[model samples]
Structure formats: structure tokens, C-alpha cells
Target chain A: MSESRIERGIGLLLSLIQYVTASGSVTVQEAAAHFGVPEQRIREAVERVFMAGVPDGAGDFIRFDIDFDAFEQQDVISVTMRPAFEDETVRLSPREASALIAGLTLVAGYTEAAPERVAALRDKLRSAASQGADTVAVDTLAVPLAAQRIRDAIRDRSVLAIDYRKPGAGTQRRRIAPVALNLNEGQVFVEAADLDKQGMRTFRLDRIEAIEPTHDAWPYALPERERTVTGSAQVVATRAAAAMLRDYATSEPVSVDGERVRLDIEVWSEPAVLRAVAACGGDAEIVAPASLRRAMHRFAVDALGGPSGEREQTPRD
Target chain B: MNRVEAEERQFSLLLALVDTSVGFTKHELFVRVAGYQGQPVGDALERMFERDKDALREHGIVIDVVQPPGDDSNQEARYRVLDGVLGSPAELQFDAEERDLLDLALRVWHEGGLTEESQRAALKLRADPEFRGGLPLERTPGRTSDPDGAEPATASILQPRQRPRESAFQALKRAADRRREVVFDYLKPGERTPRSRTVQPWAAVLFRGRWMLVGHDLGAEDTRTFLMQRIVSPVKDRAAKQPFEAPGDAATTALAKLEEIWATASVGVHALPGSDADIRLRHRRDTSEEDGLLVVHHADRHLIADELTGFGSDVAVAWPAEQRELVRQRLERIRDAHAEATGEAAS
Candidate 1:
């Protein structure tokens, strides 16, 4: 077996022993599923465990009691005789601690609680791991108050009256039953049933100018069919820009043809797509969907005073 | 040796190490450890012992080697797995709610390279009775009603992509954590070749879906943020050098400096009053409507340009000649590609 597999198997063994001891007994199938391993692998790991012991000692070996009936018929794991040293505290490896620390720092960014509370929790985790106290540098993408209000409405099954700023269309007041808040690629989106439009739509949280929770409760159950907006765009970019796109793109690229990378993405709104293209500078261009391509040309022409140098009447005109 | 035998040997070695308090010499370990026993004491045994030590250490097992207290000669050292370093504290406890929160925190790495470590940690915690009574594996909770549900919404937001195992990110993180100096070849934006840089890493920060390492350059005598992806070569640690102290608020300071740089670069554009571009730009912080054009201030002009291009004809860039040119070129590229495709169809 590869070294990594063995290492992972060891970690699994340690965790399994601890789990079986604490939970009294667990089925082999459940253990396999929980550890994301095949049942046969778990069985092999367990069989190996039965052979482990101190050298040249008659009674100094680790022991386990397995029910033969459950093993043969039901595939249940009953550890009647637990390891003597099961109560030993397991310390996290340095790598494990670092991974957790990085993860917690990321979580602190999305948390709605006070910064101090999150910091304290992080400190506690560091102390538990016996690591030095250097504060992690995290870009706390603070959720807007409007987004928070929408989240609360989703939880309470209430309707939200929001002054939403839709791209190309300006601010409009609408009442909608907020269903779910999705976080895709560091952006927050609210999937709601638009009362006026009478269909499902997604609104970028940052574009929500103002939101007020109404007393009216949601009258309908969540729609069974998820409203997913998926599209693909092809673009040619510089190597540097391509790397950035690979990192920030919603999903993996569909194909890479020299400098051009075609991306299959789930877009929340049309403006979001424009925002992505804008971020790429001149390095990336959308190659498909004639409407989107024309939109790009128009956006450029409009920004440059309509291919004529004459000042446009308005930013959108 | 067979895979099972290798595992059995490792497990036996672990048991032997954990069972002892006084420590063991190489000779004693060869006899006491199940796998090493009955083997001839020679070059083969020594090599096997050395490899086993490294394998165990890689799994986060702490083994300590120290000379006997009264020993004068440089003889064989006694080795022991450090006590209390491999296990959780007995007094450390987590309530169900705290466990749920931890579950949420751990779930953030579901898509990243840290998923395995996070999963193991979660399983370790779940072994405790206090945290075991919660729901079985479920997806992140969509609403607050099921806070302890499968997946937390926050975790889904800002999904971190899995980084390469040998990425510069891991190296920089290690250096920052150890307060060590690192040297690497870095490629700045628009630069073709990479230049070597010696820096004292302070922190690794993620902003706008990209990882940046904040560090103090020794040669330049200035603090800078190096994009992780732009790092072209392996990050090498300077050995046998005194580590420098990281500034207390290094991360915050670096982020603020980046934000400051962005604030100074503004682009002027024209959009309809209620158009999507106008609404979104107006909603953005540090943006204002000036005269007949809206001036948008951003940290990264390229990123802003990409976003603006999506608006398509709905907005116009009025100022910042370079940004306007970038948009024009991008539009031209798209138009040319479409024309070529259409021409082929007509032919």
C-alpha cells in the first residue's frame, strides 16, 4: 500500500478505537460509511488490529471481543473488550492543528456573531492544541445588514420587503418569501419567490439596498425543483489571468484551448457574469451567447462614449 | 513485508511506545516492539527503525530522544513518545451546541485539501459522549431552525478550492507559523520572468477569492503582499537563522494597506441612473456619482474591469484611459471571435 493510505488507515484505526469505546458498539457498515471507506477496507484494518501486541509478552497484547454471529450474518462490530488505554487523550498533530486554525479563521469571516466571540473561540482552539498565540489574518467578508435581515426572514418563514437594486433596472421595492441563502464563490445570494414576479429568483446580498421583515408568514412550501442558473463562457486570457480565473471561477474549466479556457458556471445573475468579466480586465472575453457578447461590446462602446467620443447622456444610456 | 504486517508492526511499535514511561534504548526497542523483535541487530534493523520513527512522526506522533541524566559519554540515546502530547485533555469538554458549531467550522474545508484532517478531527470529537447524540451525517442547515443540521450555509459561501499539496501556500503558512524567513522566486503582475525574493512571512490572508502572503522583504526593507499563485518557485526556508518577530497586527495591517492601495485607484464610468451597473456600483463602498459620470474606486482595477464588462453597453467608462482601453480590447476580442464563427457558418 502507498504510504499515504497507510497513514490514513492508521488515523482511521485510532479514531475507530476511540469511537467504538465511546459509542459502546457500531456496525461495520456505519463505520465504513462514516470514515468514507469501503466495508472491506474497514474489515481488513480491524483484522490487522487483532494481530497487534507487545513483543515476547504472553498477556500484554491489546484485545477485542467480536460477536461471531453479528460478524458473519449482520456485519455488526461489537467491541466488548475495549483497549485498556482508551481514555488516553489524543493530541492533534501540528499539521492537523494548522489546518483547523486556517479553517477557523475562514469561518470567523462568515460568522454573524461578535468578532470578539469568534476570536475567543479561536484562542481556545489554539490553547487546546498548545500552539503559540499569533492571530490569524482573515479577510472577514462582513455580511451586510440587509443580508442578515434576509437570513432572519428565511429562518422565521417570513416575507421580506426589500428595496433591491437589480442590475440594469435600478432599485425597486418588492415583497418576497425568502427561502435560502447561498454562498457561492465568496458571494452571498438569496433565493426567494418574488411576490410580484411570482417566480423564483436570486438576488445578490450586496445589491440589496434595504430590507424589512414583514409580519406575513410564508404561505407556500419550498419549491421542490431548485432554481439553478447554469451557463458556459469561453475566454482567452494571459497565463496570469488564466490562473486567477481557475482559482476564482465557479467551477472547473470545461476545456482549455491554448490561452482560451471555457468555463461551465452557475451564474446567480447577469450582472454577476459582467462583474467576473470586468475583474479579468482585457485578458478575458466571453465567446458565446451572442447576447452576452453583444452586451460586452455595448458596455465597452457605452463606457467609451458610444464608439463616437460624444458623451453619453447617462451611464446606462 | 505485506501491508497487514507493516500496519501490525507500526501498531505494535505505537503500543510499545505509549506503554512505556522510562523510555527505551535502540537495543531494548528491537526486543520489545513486536515488529522489530527476532530480527538480527544490524544495518537492516537500524534502517527499519529509522524509517519507522519518521513514519510515526509524520502522523503527528511526538517522539523525544534525550541522553540519560548522568551519562558523560556520547552513547546511545533513550527515546520515548512524549507523554500527554498524543491525546486530548481529560478535562476538555464540548457541549452539543459547541460540537455543532465545531461541526460547522470543520465543514468549511469540505472542498479544500484540509477535508481529511477536518474529518478526522470531527470523528475524534464525536467520540466523546457529549457530542455523539447529535444527528447523523446531514447536509449544512439552510435555515437557523436546524443549526446542528448537515451543512451550514456559511460553509457553502466562499468555497475554498483545494490547493496543491506542494503549493507555496502551505510553505508560506508554515513559515509564518514558525516565524521563519523564506526565499522564493516571485512573478509580479505583467512580469514575464520571476525574481528571487527573501522575506520574513507574517501571515497568509485570503481576499476576493485569492490567497496573499504578507511578508517583510529583507533586501527591499519594506512590507509587501505577494500573491500565492504568482510565486513561481518552491518556498525555501533559511536554515540556522534567527527568526524575526511578526508585527502584532500584521494581517490586519497588510489587509488595510491593500485596501488603501485600492482606494487611490478610481475609474470614471457612466451608467443609467437605475441600471444594474449604476445600482451595483452605487451600492459598492467608496463609489460616488460625480457630475455626469460615476467614479468607482476599487482595489484591483482588472477585477473591476471584468465586472464592468458584464454590464455590456449598459455602462460606459468615461475616465481612466487605460481601463477604458482594456474594456475596448476585450470587447473587440469577443466581437472578432463571434464574427469568425459566423463567417464560417455562412461559408
Candidate 2:
């Protein structure tokens, strides 16, 4: 076909062969799925390998011995006789190496283990790929002391008492069975079973002013299904706010009709929903759920110190 | 040539180039490689050979062009793949624990643009006999074996928005890695026009949900952080007449500088006690209540306003007249929109 297609085909074949050689035996279906290609393409590539060899070779020609019976009956590709270079490891392309290096560097930043071990591993990967170590950099979010302590409690499976600052509620002592730690965007969240609330709750790590491991052991097993601290909200807004909505919304807008765009958003809390709506200024309104609408009206009236007509503007110098 | 023939030729060419220690000259390669065989020695063969070399290089195979030790002429350049460059080192091996750790580390890229590379690396590691028997790697969080309808709860669930053009990021990353300067037209957050800048890129960092290029702006004579999203023009590599070493903690320093900017710019808001607005704003780091007003530190006033607007009547911008006016305007608009929608519904 076209030149670049042929080039890509060869690259895919080379990578597939490398993978098969390393893994010993991989099914044709597995190969197809892993490389995100059609099964027929993988089969054709394998068939081509039988005809490919050194030009002047007598008995040492390169060949892949496929199990014909298994292939015909069960769609299994068992390479009976591996290629001569099967022992040779597949070399990474410079772009591939660079991408991996960048990824590893980012991982190193987030890792909580010994700094030296991560540093050594990063150096090894760089040297092996013939790439410089400092090519890619990442600055991980600084984990607070309280967050670190909470992490320790998670690993130890202990009950933790934290001086958590819940929005509007002020600081309060919370005892929770620390389950897991999650990082979303740049913020860290701790998923735990609030012993007092007796339900799953997510605490933003930064909001935890103080945390201590209670000597008591974990009282319950982690739930089979991890509860996500996110909910979807729909809103209609002006073009400017809609533009901002596109930025903050987790996904694309559900629908857009002129300046009013309907967006389905996943936010951490009900307050987060209110915060997002407020961020839009007054250009946006939550159109669905009559209950939420009433709440918004109340929230607005309260902030204004009365109804819209009589509300006084508390201007500050 | 057909697909099989083209690949066979390339494969034969690789075998020839890699087999020889001294490397093969142009004439020797044409005679030895299978694809070049049977073809008449002419421009056609030369063109095909050139294309093959490019294809191989694109796959990260480095073919070294070397002159025979005794010969001192530019002509008759010989080529060979360098030793160990394409092959794994014999001494390099990983135990079960290290392999597991690597498998875990590679998982971080599940939502990133580097999935293909990470997958290839994982396959490469799995190929080794020692690592073959290790525990099966855990699937990405959302794809786990948990019962259906169990919402995948990842702490860091928000993936960075995919950039419109990744080439800018790739170019900036390369320049930073090579210690080279780059020139590009940048649009500041609120500015209407773009400005050209020349800087020695120190580090490319992901901060506050965006990729930022931090570097020494030669014109401003100060370190500046440029948002990748706001880079209006393609990043062009500058001539490397002089290169400066990146500080050992370049990334950390750049992030600290961003934090400093946020710390210096503060805003004040009055939220009714026990309201969602008051609770959420108070929970934010570096925010405190002073005389019934919530004092918030932020990098972008517009961003803070966006947050405050979501609270409706529960919160009011207490200071920074510009931000207060912004919130006021937004609230009025929302109020007007709501009244219109309700009026239509009632009718």
C-alpha cells in the first residue's frame, strides 16, 4: 500500500515478534488486543515471518514454526520454533524511550518509598535507553505531615483520629478507619469509613489539620465496592461561563443550545456543586431537580441578605 | 514491492548491518541485503536504501556511520548497530519484588498519553524468565473486578485535559532536557494579544491541573512560568550558542515559585457561618476566618471568583473591589436568567 503504512506495519510486526519471543507463547487474539490491531493483521504478519530470511542463507534462514492444527481449529498461535533472534530484547525507539522516561520521572516524584531506590531505577532506565536522566521533570504535590500520618494509618490498618476542617462546619475531631489514599488533579483525598458517621467519606488531605493513629485496630473489612466521593450535576450557563464550564467540567457538555449549555459534572461534594455554580457568577442556573433549585434560591437570598429586590450590596473598599 | 517483500528486505538488511563488526559499505549492503538483491545498481536502489535507514531510525534503531580505522576519507561510510544499544545487557536483571514495583509504577500512566510506551515496557519486562512468575499486575482502578455499579473511586480521578497540540509539550520537553533555549509567542491568562519570548527552558512541570514550562526569560531577566495552554505559537528551538545548566532542584524551585505567587495574592470573602460556601472555602488550605470573613490565598483572582460564584447568596466577596464586582455581575446574571426561566415555566 502506501509507504508509511508499510513502515508502520513493519514496526508493528517487529514489536509483536519481540513480544512473542519474550512471553514464550502468546495467542493470536492476545497479540491483536495488546497492539490494538485486527486479528487478521497479526495473522498476516506472522505468515510473512515464514518467508522472511537472510538472502544467502542455506539452513540458517529465519522462520517462525506455527502450530497449524491449533491455528486452524482453535485460533491459537503457538510458535513451535521461535525466531533466531528470539533471545534478543526489543530495543525502544527514541520517542518511546523518552515517553517512558518522562512517565517514570513523574512516578518517582509521587512515590513514597526510599528516594535513593527511585533515583537509581530512573538512572538505570535512562542509561539503558541511552537517554539523559534530566530530560523529563515533574514536581509532585507536597504531601503534608498530617497526610503522611494518615497514609501510615492506612497501611497499618488502624483507626485514625483527625482534626479535620469540614467546609463551613469548622474544625472537628473525626475518627475514621483509614482505607485508601487517592490523588485527583493535584489534590490528595483520603477515602475512609468515618467511624462516627458510620459511612464512607472522602477527606481532602490538606483540610486535615492534625491526625493521629489510634492504638485501636481496624474494626471492619474494607467494602468490596469502593465508594466514590463524586456526583454529577447539570447546569445551563452563558457563553463565557460555558467556556469556563468546559474547562472545569469533567467531560464535554451534554448539550448546548445557544449561550445555554447543559453540562453533566462530577464534583466531590454538594458544596462543590454550589461552588462551581457560583464560579459561573449569575450567568448559569441549575435547570433540573426542583429541590436543588429551591436550595440555590435560598443560598442566593441568604448571601444577598434578602430577596433580590430589597437585597443590599455590601460593598467593600 | 508488496508488504511482505518490503519487511523481508528490511529484516535482512538489519541482520546484515548487525552481523558485521566493521559495518557494511554502501556497495556491500546492496549486494548482501535481500531487498536490494536482483535490483539493478542505480538511483532506485540508493533511494530505497535511504528510506530503509530512515524507517529503522524511526523505530529507535541507531545505525552508526563509521570510517574504517586506516582509511581517512569521507566517502565509503560503513554502518552498524552499536553493541548493546539494541540488545539487553546480560548483567541487568530484576527480582520479583522490583518487577512488582515497576508494574505498579507503570500503572500511573493508565490515564496519560504514554500508555503505548508503558505497555511496551511492561511486555519487555514480562519477557524475562525471572519476572515471568511474578504476581499478575493489578488492573487500572476503574477496570478492576469489583461488582458492577461500584463507582471507581480513585483519589486523583481528574485526568489532565488533553492538549490540542502535544507537539508544543514534546518540543519544550526536548529543549529543557537538552538545556537549549526556545522561542515562542505566549498569551498571558487575561491578555488579548500574544507576545514573543526567548528563554532557556529549565523544566516542564504539571501543576494546578496544567502543564507549565518554567525557565529563565532572557528578556524579562527573571524566571517565568508559561502555561502550555496559553502558548499561542509553536515552540521553536533557538541556536545553542550558550547553554546553562539546570539547577539540581529545578522542578522543586519552579513549583515553590508558583506557591510564592499564590501566597502573596490573597482575597477576602464573607460567608454565612454553617453555609456550604463558608464550609468549602474554609476547608481550603491557607484560608482562615478573620472577624467573620474568610481570608483566602490564591494565584488567580478570576479562579477564586469562579469558586465563590458557585456559593450563591451564602458568600460575598468582601474585598478586592475588582473580584467583588465580578462576583456581583455574575450573581445578577444568574438571578436574571433564573427569573426568566421561571417566568416562562409559570406561563
Candidate 3:
């Protein structure tokens, strides 16, 4: 085996030895499961490796005293004597501590997890870690109430009256039976059954203006989600815009010209495609499907025209 | 001479080190340790010893070296494991609750970047004498509900995961830990070209859902932050220069700077009531309503513009002439991209 690979195994082996020594006796099967290793590796590790200690006078050797009979017959490993390395504490390297601590900090930030307990746990990890673990940090945002409420509604199977705003439309009250929730790139999306629309729609949690539980329960058995691809469109993209389009593309993008790519994309909704095109900001254009291009033109024109109807525009702040 | 397995050799060396009181000289170790006993004592043997010592150091074990006075040329030295260099592991103990929290933390990064570190840490923690008895902590009530009825690895039902490990993140983090400077090509948003930056990385922070490297830009001669996503080239270590010490409070300082920017960069928008813009912006953290206008503060102006552009005709930029112009330009581009005869309409 390579030197580094063996070194990594040494860490595992050392930890395993310490565990065995501390526990006094454990089944090989139990040891294998605990370490997430197969039973054969565990048996080999004990029998072939870590069985020897320092050589003594006259070419003799001092070795760890294991119960050979019990180990061979009953698949049990009992370390009777450890000639050296007596300590049994689990030591975390600096990087190990950092990874764990960074993860804990992220969780503690987003949820109302017990603050005192997290703090106490963090301090313990810091104390246990080697030097240089504290250099990594993660920023936390406030707990989003909308996400919390939606999660509760999903669990209760309760019907909800939510005022949801589509991309270009005003908030419309809809009775929804929310099911699964997904988070991508810090945005929360909920898949729900829209009673009025009679189909499932994915609603951005942030776009939900207000959500209240209805007295009625979810009316039917849970339904499988609708197919994601309702339509397809072709677009020409500049290099920069291609990078952004790659994220939303349902299929592989093919290079068309120098610094440009042709992408055949699945369109989940008209509004979604328009927003993506707008985000690209002219670097990408809808090449075919004349209707989408027309919609894109109208989308921008209406946006530039500003708010219509009752509320008169306030002067620019 | 038979080649001994690396593990047995290392283990024997460790046992010898831990057993000796005064320590062993280089020649004595080669002549005595099981792995090197039959090998010829020479440069190759010495190099092998050095490599083993370095490997042990990676495991956080430091061997104490005792040198003879006035023997610099002779290279007379002795080595042994010290009492506490390997840490007083026997004294380390975690209660049941802490163990559960540790397990939860370890499971956060499933299989990338930090997974190896977290897994090794888990193995080490399982060695703790108290680890055997504790059942994994139960999920806290009310807030703990997984929508799919899948068992969550963490205590919280809301598993907001870290973004997939950034390509440049591990390099920058390793540099920060070792205090090494790194060089990479950074592509700033809206720029057509990338510029090479040599920076002394100090901290890696996850700020506002993005991985950012906070470091001192050697070229700019100032502390700067670079978004990891914008790094267009592989990060390579500048090995000629010696490593330098980083400030103890690098993370705290970087976070404070980001927070300050987020507090000051405010934009105003007029959204039709009950529209996507109105609802999302109003619910956004740190938003204020003034004269029926939604005022939002963010660290990046382009990000705000991009979000507003996504709302299409439902929202309009209301203030800060520069930001308003930026939104207007984006909208015009979108409109012109689909205007059919694009040349004259684009200009």
C-alpha cells in the first residue's frame, strides 16, 4: 500500500485499538459495523496487523495479549494486555475539528436548536481540537418564518390559504395542500396541490405573502409530482450567459459558435424562462419558438412601463 | 531483506518511542526497531525514518528530539515521544448529548471537501469511553419534521445544507491553515477578462450562502475578499515565499466587514402591492417600507438588480440613479434581445 494510504489506515487502526481497549471486549461484527468497515478487514486488522509490539532480548518480541482462542472460535476480540500506548482518549486533528465546528455553526444559525447546548458543544469541540481550528467561520441568516410555517403545514397535512404572487401577477389567494419542500442555493421551494388550478405548482416560499391554515384537511391521497418539462425552447447564449444557462438547463448544452452555445432547455413555466432570459440581460436570446420570444418582448415592455392601476407611483426615494 | 508492512513498522516505532525513557539515537533505532533491524544503516534508512516521523506528525503526534551540545556537524540526536505532545487523550470525555451533537455535525457534509476530515473525527470520537452508552439524541419536538418522512441526520428537521464544496475552497482553506500564499485567476462579474491575484489567504467564510476567501491581496497591498465562485483558474501555492502568520481574529474581522457593507448598501423599489416583488422584498431580511416603497439593503448591487430583473414588469427601481439606470439598461437589453430586428432596437 502507498505510504499515505497506510498512514490513514494507521489513524483508523489506532482509534479502533483504543476503542477496543476501552470497551474491554467487543464482537468483531460489532467493531466492523461501528467503524463502517467489513468484518474481514476488522479481523485482518487485529490478527495480521497491530498484533506485534517491541522486540525484546534474544530476538524475542513483546506483543499485545489478545484472547486468540475466543477471537478464532467465537469472533471476539479481547485485548488483555497493551505493552505500550496506554492512553484511550479520542483526539481530533485541527482540520477534523474545523469541519465539525463549521457544520455545527451553520446548523445553529438557521434553526432554533438549543442555543445553550450548541454553545456548550462548540466549546467542548474547541477544547478537544488541536490548534488552528477556529480560523474558519460561517455567517448565519435569521430563521425564515415562512419556511417554518410551510414546514408545519406539510407535516399536519393541513390545507392552507396562501396569498401567492407569480412572477408578473399580483398576489392571488389560493387554497393549497403543501407537500414536499426543497432548498436550492438558499431559496426554499414548496411543491403543493393548487385547488383552483387543479394541478400541482412549485411556489417559492419568499413569494408567499401570507399563509394561514384552513379548517379543512388535505382532501386526497398524496399525488405524484407532474412531469417537470412542459415545453422546450432553443436559445443562443454568449459565454457568460451560457454559464448562467447551464444551471437551469435540463439537457446538455452544445457549442454553436465561438464564445456561444446552443441550449435546448425544458421550460417549466413561461414566467421561469422569461426571468432566466432577463437575468442573462441580452447575452442570451430565444432563437426559435416565436411565441416565447413574443412573450419575452412583452414581459420587458410591461416591466419598463412600470406599475399600472390604483396605486399612484410615489416619487423616487 | 523482506519489506515489512508500513503499518507494522510504524506501530512498532510508536511502541518503541512510547516505551523508552531517555529516547533512542538514530543508529540505535535502525539497529533495533523491527522494520529496520535487518536493513543496512545508511542515507536511505535515515530518509525512511524522516518520512515516518513526518507521517506521525500528520496524525498530530510530535516526537521530541534531543540534540547533543557542540555536535552540529556530527548530527548526534535522540528522539522520543513526549508525555503530552500527543495530547492528554485520557482526560478527554464527552457527555451523551455532546456526542449526538458531534455526530450530527459530522453528518452535515455527506461526501465532499470535509467528509474525510469529519469521518476521521467521528472514528476518533467513537474511541471515547463514554461513546458506547449513549443512544443518538432524539429529534427535538415541534421544529423537527422531515417532509418526506426520511430520517434526518441532524437534530433539526430543516436541513439547509452547505452549497456543494467550491472548487477553490479546499485550496484556499489549506493555504489558510498552513499560512501559505496562493495565486489564482479571478473573474469579476461583468468583466470579460480574468486577472491573476496572489493573496495570503487568512480565512474561508461562508457569507450569505456563498463561499468567500478573505485574504491580503499582495498585488493590491490591501485586505480583500473574493467570491470563490468567480475564481476562473485553479489555485496554486506560491512556494518560494515563506509562510506568514495570520491574524487570530481573521474570521471575525471578515464577517464584520461583510456585515458593514450589507448594512450600508441600500436600494429602494416601488412594487405593485401584492406582487412578487412586493411580497418577496417585504419578507426579505432587513427590509423597510417607506412611503409605500420597499427599501432593501444588500452587499452586492448587481445581485439586487438581477433579482429585480427577474420580477419583470411587476417591480421598478425607485431610487439611487445609478441602480435605477442599471435596471433600466438590463430591461432594455431583455426587451431588445427578443425584438426581432435586434440591431437598431438594441442601440
Candidate 4:
């Protein structure tokens, strides 16, 4: 049997018992949502598991003595006679402790939270861990220097003129009304209203060349739309490249051989896919959408030089 | 046993053990415990008891074993839960502000391997009476401009919103915890082919938003740190001749080495003022300007090379002939791969 399931089950039961004991009385629905479990599982746990107890030496068992009457009719659970134990608060398993500690370590590097307080909290967590808290290490990227100024712009709701880098295109100057900063997939992005394009644009935080503060306030009141419009293309990827593309594959393998397989992948940006293909270093090829294939060639040619560069050669196929 | 029965058995066993003044022997437990009762006395029953002990220990319940004096063969032994072993102290408390910080940190792990771990930890914390009545963290006012009330810009800017994990992360972590050897295909930077590596995983460290596994590489017979993203194939556990013992401080050692590399490694680049590379590299942490060139500090050469390659003609590597060669090779491979067009017009 998978031990994780058993661990999860036991942890759930103990936590549920503690929650009900502490809350005095809680609805089954609320408990279900709180634990992210199904209502049926909660009912089963309460009705069949916690209602009973272990056997004592004197031919009698110590029962939890739950108020099953209220539970049956009102969807509420209450533990009347608690189990006979001192200090029954749940202790975190090693995995659990490591997760929290690692997360705290990362947050400490960039957050405005006081360093002393965070350190104290880490100590507290270390003490609470059953064992082996020190085995999991975490390090986070320091907040970029541009991040603080960007936060200030978002807070002030001010229009800022900035130079932003577009992949395959040189730096372009634009005025944007700053909104929120989003961190996704280890990269930071700023959601803003682009005045030049009259649309919302998400700019990579690292790609901003310079921020020129403007006194003008944000003028548009546009609601945020779907952040990305995914586009799909078919490609033949080597086993190595296929592994990287697995996350973006939209359909089952169109066909598979020993070495290469055809996959239909969906991506938010065509240029990003081109870059990924370029990173693969010829392990992947665009098999469909003639325009995209041509675009792939053009993307690489431009990266090397222009159409008139000395390296430009004839087609391979 | 099924899940429900197993859970009930463990809980009852824990309760029985904690309630006892003197621990119960294996035979006594099998005869008395509700779930263990009525089982025939045999090797299977003994294995079940041992497995139960392991499961309880995995859940952080420390079961103390009392043995007869000098009984090396374990002919007579009893098991019971030590006092105060099941939960943290009642006084292990957190203030409102501290809880708020913890809440934000815990919330950052979503849809990742650590998500469940964080949730389980949060549940344990919430079970404390001191934490009662703190159901939802209050949002700071005036920062709720998002229509859906997304996280405020301040919090988002200060922390990572995603873990950026690889497919082999969970497998590697489990293999490390179990002290098992794992085999996977790894593609190192600047290398076209992937190589199979067999290693005894020691610990996994999250450095710079990437999961890196620190382990003893069998082929190299030395401790090596591998970035998880470079693992190109599924991680498979290979039974070792004997379970390897991990160094207790493996994580700290790996982190110290990474920091050392980050401090010592330097690369020089030339970027035009107000250019993309200029802005990106200038604001990078630990970056400095020397001789009218940007000195970018990096932990790994190939990773930084990948970033510089993205800049195209806007930036050029100035020093460190090896790094310059790496970037040059990558650019050339990209160019060579597409140099031959398939009879198509430039789109």
C-alpha cells in the first residue's frame, strides 16, 4: 500500500478530531470544506471512526461519546467526552515541517516581514517539528531592484513611461498605467494598461529597461480579461524534447515511434515556443502550420543575423 | 487492510498507547486492541504490527519501546507513546502578525508538490486552541482594486507565487527520504545527448525557485548537485545493495556550496545604455559595473549563458572565454538548425 495515503488519512482524522474539539460544534459541510474532503468521507469518519474508542483493561472501552443525535439530524458534530489524553494537539510529520520551514525561508528573503520575527517563527517551527527539519533547504531569488519602484507605481496608480523589451524586437518606449505585479513560474510580470497599444499588457519585470515616472494618473477603467490566449501547433519532438513539451501537450500522441513523437502543443505565445524550439537545438521541428515553420526559420535566421547574413544557406529538406 | 479500517486501527492503537501507564507487548496488543483482535498468531501478524509501528512513526508519533534488561533478542518488549510526543506544546503560539506572515507563505505553494505538505502543516497549526477564531486573514485596505480580489501587489511582489517544479521532484524527494537510489536521464547544458545517472539522493534544496537534488553519484563516486530541470527522464527507484545513510546536514552543505559559487562566479558583458540587457543585468542582485562593463554574478555559467542568448545582439559577453564560447555555440546551433529553410516564404 502507498504509505502517503495512509499518512494522509491518519493526519486527516487527527486534525478533524482536534478541529471539532476546539470549535465546540461545527457543521459537516463546513468541516468538509475546511479539510478539502468529501462530505461522505467526513460523515464516515465521524459516524464510524471517532464515535468509538479503544478497549480498556477492565473489559470496558473509553468512547469519544459524540453527540450522534445532533449529527444525524442537524449535520453538526460535537465530541462530548473527549479521548483521555493530555495535550492532544497534532504534531507535524517531518515532511510537513520541512515544507513549511522551506516556504518560510524563501519568504524571509524578499518579504517586508521583520527579519527578527521571521527568525523567531522559524525557531518555533523547528521546535514543533517531530524531527529532521534541517534536512530541507530553501533559497529564493532576491527581489530585483526594479520591483520596489514598480510596487510604488502600482500603489500610486500612476502612468509611467518605460522602455520594455519585446523578444526578437529591440527595446521600445511606452507609457503604461501600472497595476499589480504577478510572479509566475519563477519570473515576475507586471500587469498594466499600455497607452501606446490601448490595451492591457503583461510585461516581464526583468525586461523593463527604464522607468520614467509621470505625474499623470491612470485614465482607463478596463476590466482584466483572460490573461493569455493559447495557440496550438503540431511538432515532431525527440524523446528529450518531448519530455520538456509534455506539459504543453493538448492531445494524446498523434503517433509515437522509438525516437520521436508527434504532439499537438498549446502555448500562450508563438515567440516563446520558437525560443523553446531553439533551445532544444534541432531536437524538435515544427511539422505543421507552414507559417509557423517559416516563422521558426526566420526567428533563428534573425537571431544569427538578417536575411543577408553570410551564414544564410539552402533549405535542409 | 482497507483505508478506513487502517485509520481506525492506528487511532485506537495510539489512544491505547498514550493512555497506558505501562506499555503493551506485541502479543498483548494483538489480543486486546479492537482491530488487532481475532488475528491468528503468526509471522503475518508480526509483520502487520511492525508496519503499524512504522506508519505511526511516519505520522510523527514517537513510540517508546521498553525492553527487558539486556534482552538483545527482543524476546520481551513493550511499546507506548511518550508523554507530550503527539502534539506541540500548548505555549508554542503565534501572534496575529506572525500568523498572517505564515498564512501568506503557506498560500504561496499551490498546485505543487509542497501544496499538500503545507496544507497538512497548516491544519496542524490551526488545531491549536490559541489559533482558534483566526479563520481568515484580513486583507490590507485600499489594495483590493482587483475585480476578483487577487492578492495585493505588495504581497505578490515580495514573494514567489509559484514553485516552478519539475516532474521528477516528488519522486526525488521520496527517494531521498527513503534512502533509495534513483536513476534518471540528465541533459547537461551545452550537451546534446542525455546521460543516465544512478545516485543515492540525500536531500532536495529549493534554490532560486528551482529544486536541486544533492546526492552521491554512483558513477562519479562523489557528491554532486543536480538541478531538477536538467533531469530529462522519469525518475525510477533502483534498489541499492544496502540502503545508503544520508549525511544529516546535506541540505546545509549543498546550500553553502551554492552560495559560495554565486559569490565567486562572475561574468562580464557589454550592453548599450538603456538597452534590455543593460536594465536586466544592472538591477540583478550582486551585479556591479566595472570598466564600463556590467559584471553579472551567477551561480551557473550555462544558465546565465541561456539568459544572455535571449538578448540577441543587444548584449555581448566580454570576458571569461569559456562562457563566451558557450553562448556562441548556443547561438550557432540555433542558427544552423534553421539555416536551411523548407521552401517557404518568410512569414
lDDT, candidate 1, at A246:
65
Give per-residue CA lDDT, model 3, range A1-317, as digits (tens): 11223224567677777878877899998876566566777887786445567667445568887898999999998998776657633356666777778777755544435888888877777777666535667666565777777767766667899988787466699999876565544567778888777778888888887888889767565555676777887888664565566666766657675445678777878888888877765667777678888888888898887758644445463
How would you encode candidate 4's per-residue C-alpha lDDT over B1-347 as one tens digit per residue? Answer: 42337667777777778777788887778766767777778897788777787777766677888998888776578888865466543533578767766766675665555775676676666655444321222222233346335445445444346544477888887677667799998877556677999999988787766678899999999999987877877899978866788887888899999989999998887765666557777877788998777889888888787767666555667788787777777677555555554422112
lDDT tens string, model 3, B116-155? 5665666677666455321122312122344555543334
Quote the true-contact fraction of every model.
0.35, 0.31, 0.48, 0.37
Task: Score every model by TM-score.
Answer: 0.72, 0.62, 0.79, 0.83
lDDT comparison, 2 vs 4, better candidate: 4
Query: What TM-score, to 2 decimals, does candidate 3 have?
Result: 0.79
Error of 4 at B281 (Å): 3.0
Task: Put down candidate 1 lDDT per residue, B1-347, tens digits, no spaces.
Answer: 42336666777777777767877777778777767777888998889887777666645676788797788563477888876465553423565444545655665555554555565565555455454311223322223344334443443332333344226876776566556799998767544456889999886666655677787888798998887777756789865265588776776687777777767988888875566666677766668877878888876665566566666666678777777766666656544544433222111
Model 2's DockQ score:
0.24
Leading candidate by TM-score: 4
List, residue by residue over A246-305, the lDDT tens digit for candidate 4.
667777554455445678788678777776665555566776666677777666555555
User: All candidates: CA RMSD in angstroms?
Assistant: 6.6, 8.4, 5.7, 5.8
- Please give, for residues A81-171, the per-residue lDDT of candidate 2 as tens digits: 7544555644654345445555444444444556677667666665656332233345444445666676556555679898877654668
lDDT of 1 at A51: 60
Candidate 3 retains true contacts at a fraction of 0.48
